[model samples]
Structure formats: structure tokens, C-alpha cells
Target: MIQLIECPRDAMQGLPEFIDTAIKAAYINQLIEVGFHTIDFGSFVSPKAIPQMRDTAEVLEMLDLHKAKSKLLAIVANVRGAEDALRFEEIDYLGFPLSVSETFQQRNTNASIAQALETVETIQNLCQTKGKEQVVYLSMGFGNPYGDPFSPDLVAEFVQKLDELEVKTISLSDTIGVATPELITEIFQVQITSFPHITFGAHLHSRVEDINEKVLAGLKGGCRRFDGALKGFGGCPMAKDELIGNMATEVMIETFKEEGYSLDLNQMELEEAIKLSNSIFL
Candidate 1:
């Protein structure tokens, strides 16, 4: 069975206007009923970096956790953010973006690659103490536009280092939608083959036309964990050049259905959530 991680936080963080905390909670509460494996709901980072998510804590407090079967995941950029997120016992996963490209590592997290590794160590230790699982997102995992010498070998080295740190869940992120189907298959095949114990996920930003090819490539390469946004509304605003749209959750679900996988999502609640999304976005 595949694990679907619905990324509302990513969809919202790049928006220009702040989504009211009540609206965020209501939408997320409805999403919980749809029974996703996990919900990437919010972030605990500098408000200046992602102003739309400034009220994440307030939204979390308002969620009806008693009705939620989905695990909560929050994005964190540094040790302080991770520490802040850990204060909430309701959060099950703390996701940190560790960019393979030095340029994006500094842009997204304000740290170089080496410094971010140190930060990851600190955050991992803290999560262990707080009983929260740490999820490291290998941002710019496919390729970077900054001319930062990218190849499948570079990705392997980064994953190996993360594995040495004992990070169990690593999501390979195509931050700029630069990944080709062949590239997706090759790297995922290598990583899953190398690290049998780790959970690998594909977080791809894509043009609508590339969705099927990319998603199928990841599946062909043995990835079962995937991340998606409700309507492909958001991407890394901090990425170089033009920002790309996220993979649409509808497409992912449809693709999986065609593959004969039963996700067991509540169709009625999902419809409600989609309507709720229309209200929150824009």
C-alpha cells in the first residue's frame, strides 16, 4: 500500500495572503476525515520567511485531533523551528529541507550545506528526545538550475550521508520541476536499492503534462511514499528562476486507482475538503 502525504502547508506557504487560522483549521479538520496517511499541515519557521503560515500553532490548537486518523507533519528549517514544532505532541513528523545544492540550501534555510548538516544532527537529536520522527527532504534532489554540478552520483552521496545520520525517511524533492522520467527511475532505483531500511518518497513539482510520467517512474523505481498538494497550486518560491506547480493530488490518486490500488479515502469528505480548499486558496 502507498502512503499519501497531503501537503496543505506547501500549498499555502507560498500564497500572498494569509489564510485565516480558523479557515486553515477547518480545512485541515476536514482533510483528517479523508484518511490520508499523513497531512503536511503547517510549518514552524520564521514568519518573515513564510508569512502565510504565521498562525500555524494557533491552527494546530483548533484541529479536532480526536477525529483524525492521519499523522500530522510540519515543516521546519532549523533547529529552533524543529524545537518549536516538538512542543506540540499532536505533530508526528518534523520535515526539514536539506538541499543538495549549496545555493538553495542557503536560500531556503539560510545555511550552507555543511552548516545544515550540523543543524540536522541537532534537530534529529531533539526529535529523538521528544518522540517525534524526523523527515529530511532532499530539496533540489533531481537537479539545480544554479549550475551546481548535479548528477545521480551527487544524490547518492547526499543520501548516504543522511543515512549515516540515521535519518529513516528521506524524500527526494524536484524543487524546480527539472526531473525527467528516466532520471526519476534511475535515482529512486539506486537509493531504494542502497538503503533497504529507509523510506524513500518522491516530492515532485511538475507541469501537468509531466505528472503521469514522473509519478509512474517513481513507482517503477520502488517508491511508495508520495507528496502532493490539493490542486498543484504551490512550489518553492525561493527556487531560482520561475517557480513550478506541485504535483496534483487528484492525478496521483487517479494514477494509483488505475494501478489497482485502493487508497480507502472517504470520497464524501474529500469532496468537502476540495470545496473547503476553494475557499481558503485565493
Candidate 2:
């Protein structure tokens, strides 16, 4: 069965509406009860850059992880962010984003892709020292707005770069939500075949209509772990203007449930989660 990694925290990064930690915790607890195998809980980056994630630690304290068998992941931008994230035992995956877009690397975190990769060694060392697993989010593996077209060959090369760095899993992210089904299949297939040993996953961004096609694309390409937001929560304010949100979890569930696939997430529990989200963000 394919595993779903719910990412409400990462998705809600630049939300215009601010849902307090308590409300977020309440909403998240509902998700936890429903049962996703993993979750990208929050980022430990500088609050000045993403004010929404400033409550990372507090949210960790508030979430009810014991309700289900799931891993909680957190995005860490640098060594410092990793350090802060390590202090919390609640986090199971330490996501280190490596952008294929050089311009995006600097604009998002004020560091080049090379510089970000440089920090990976240190971050990996820290994760090992602290006994935590690390995940590499391959952001902008799709087309970049800078007129630099993304290619499967380049994607394979970056996966090789990750292999050389001794990174574990590689998460392909459609940072700008510009990915088509054909593009998704081609990219994942090439990388999965070349890096057969590496754990393959996706962090997708698509409208409600694209859910099944995108999911099937990755599944056909041999991807087992997929990411989604509670209520279509994210779009990088730094990546582009007027972007759609992250792939919505409910939409994915509806598609899969009808197809007789499983997520371990129940329909009633899902409705409660969306209701909470609507109340808080709608």
C-alpha cells in the first residue's frame, strides 16, 4: 500500500489566515486519529523568514502522536534549524530541502544550492549524532520560473549527487505546482531506475482535478510515499506569484477510496479534519 505523508505544517507556511497553535493542534490531532503513516509537522527555520513556523516547538508539545503508528517530519533549512529540531523528540524525519533552482536557493534561504548541499554533510552528521533519520526534499526538480527548463537527466544527476552525499530518501517536490502528469512519470521513473536503492517519494502541488492523475503518475513510476496537505495549505511565496496550494489530502483520499486503495484514514475522520481546517482557514 502507498503511504501518505500529511504536511499541514509545511503547507501552511505563508497562510494569510493565522490559526493559533491550539487550533492547529486540535486539527492535527484529528488527522493523527485518522492514521497517516507519516507527517511533515513543521519547519524549524528562522521565524523572520516564516513567521508561521515560529510555534514549531509549542506545536510539537501539543500534538498527540501516540494515537497512531506514524512518523512526524520537520523541515530544517540549516545546521542551526537542524539543531533546534533535534532537541524535540517528536520529530522523526529531518527534511533538508535541496533546490535544483540556483536562484530559488538564494532567494528562499539566502544560500546557493552548492552551499545548501555543503550544509547537508554537517546536517547528516548531526542527525546521526542525535539518532534521527534525514529526508532530502528535491525542491524545483520540475520547471523553474527562471527560464531554465528542468530535465530528467538533470534530476538523475541531482539524485546521484544525493547518493554521493550519502543521503537516504529523496523527495521530489513540485515547488511551483507546474508539474504535468507526463512530467511527473518521466522524472520519477528515471530517478527510481537509476537510484534503485534510494527511498523514493513525492511532495506534490496540484488542483483538486489533478489529484488522481498525479498520484497515479508517481505510483506508475514506482513511488510509494506521497505527500499532501490537510486542506491544500501551501505554495512557496518565494518560488512564484499566484501559485496553487499543496495537494489536498481529502482529495487524494476521495480518489483512492473510490479505487479501493487504502490510506488507513477513515472518511468520517477526514471530514472532521477538513471541517476544522475550514473553520480555521476558510
Candidate 3:
């Protein structure tokens, strides 16, 4: 079965306005019933860095997890954040963005590539002890605008390093929405073939028009996991001033259905969540 990860946190984080905690929770609570494999709900990062998500803990508290079929995932930038997320038994996964580009690594997490890898190792150990899983996002996995060295081999090397650390899932992230369909196919094909044990996912950012093509390319290259946000609402604030939105979840659902994939999602609940997103995002 294809794993569809709904990323509400990604949709909300880049917004300049602070969404009320109650509203955030309400929107996410609606998503919880949508039957996504996982919901990327919130982050445990520093409030100063992402003020919009300052109330992540509060949001979690409001969720009706008793009825939730979707697993909860939270983003954490450092060990402190990981520790904070681990405190919540409700969170099933801790996600970290480990950029392949040295420049983006520092920009995104204020750490070098080596430092970030070390952090990943530490976080992995922490997750293992806490009985939670860690998802490492290979940010700038396609290519960066910063003149950094990029190649399919470079991505494979990073995947190799993460594999050594026993990271079970790695999502190749297109931080700047610059990846071509060709690049997506190449990288996913290489990684999926090379690392059979590790689950490779696509966290692609793209123009609205390019969403179907990019997602199709990843599927063609053997990617079964994908990350998407409702209505393509948000992007990495640290990447650039003009954020490129995430792959739209609704559009992705259409594509996946057309491709004859049956997703375990409630159409009624998903429609409700989409309506809720319009209210929260606007």
C-alpha cells in the first residue's frame, strides 16, 4: 500500500500570522480522521525560530487521538526538540531536515552537514530508546540554488550515511522546488534500488502545474511514500523569501487514484479537512 503522509505542519509553519492554537488543533483533528498513514502535525523547534508553531504542545493536547487512525509525526531540529517531542508518547515519529547542501544545512538548522549527521545519530538513538521512529528529510536533495555540488551519486552517498546510522525512512526533499521530473526519477530510482531496507519518500515542492508530473516521476522511479500538504499552503521560510508551496494533497490524491492506487482515506473526512484548511490557511 502507498503511504500518504499529510503534512499540516508544513502547511502552517511558513504563515506570517500566528494561527490560534484551538484553530490549529481543530484543523488537525479533522485531518486525524482522514485515514492518512501519518499526519505531520507540528514541530518541537524553538518558538523564536518558528513562532507560528509555538503552541505545538497545546495543539497536541487538543487532538482527539483516541479515535485517530493516523499516526502522529513531529518535526525537531535539535536534540532538545527531540527530547521535547519524545516526552509526548502520542507522537509516533520525529522528523529532522538534514540538508545535502552544506549551505542549506547551516541555513535550515544552523549546523554543518557533519554536525547535522551527528545530530541525526543522536536523535536516532533517542528515538530507539523512546520507542519512536525518526524520519530524516534530505533537504536540497535534488539540487540547491547556492551553487553547491549536486549529483545523483551525492544523494546516494547521503543515503548511505543515513543507512549506516540505521535510519529507516529518508525523504528526498526539493527545498527550492527546482527539481525536474527527470531528476526526481533518477534519484529515487537509484536510492530505491541501492537501499532496499530503507524506505525512501518524496517530499517535493512544486508549482501547481507541475505537481502531477513530479509525483508521477517519483512513482515511476519506485517511490511508494510521499508527503503533501492541503492546498499547497506552505513552504520553507528559511529557504527563500518567496516560499514555494508543498505538493498539494488534494491534487496528489487525484493523481494516485487515477494511477489505480487505493488509499486508505475517508473521502468525507478528507473533504472536511480540506474545507477546514481553507479557513485556517486564509
Q: What is the C-alpha lDDT of each candidate?
A: 0.91, 0.83, 0.93
Better of 1 and 2 by lDDT: 1
Candidate 3: where are CA atoms >4 Å away?
A: none
CA lDDT, candidate 3, residue 219: 96
- Those runs of model 1 whose alpha carbons end farther than 4 Å from true positions after fitting are none
Query: TM-score for every candidate vs. truth?
Result: 0.98, 0.95, 0.99
Best by lDDT: 3
Q: What would you estimate as the lDDT of candidate 2?
A: 0.83
Model 2: per-residue Cα lDDT at residue 247: 87
- Cα deviation at 251, candidate 3, in Å, is 0.5
* Per-prediction backbone clash count: 0, 1, 0
RMSD of 3: 0.7
The C-alpha stretches of model 2 lying farther than 4 A from their native spots are none
In model 3, what is the error at residue 194, expressed in angstroms? Answer: 0.4
Compared with the true structure, model 1 gives a TM-score of: 0.98
lDDT of 3 by residue, 4-62 (tens): 99999999998888888899998988988899999999999988889988999999999
Screening candidate 3 with a backbone cut-off below 3 angstroms (N, C-alpha, C), the clashing residue pairs are: none
Shift in Å, residue 206, candidate 2 = 1.2
Clashes of 3: 0
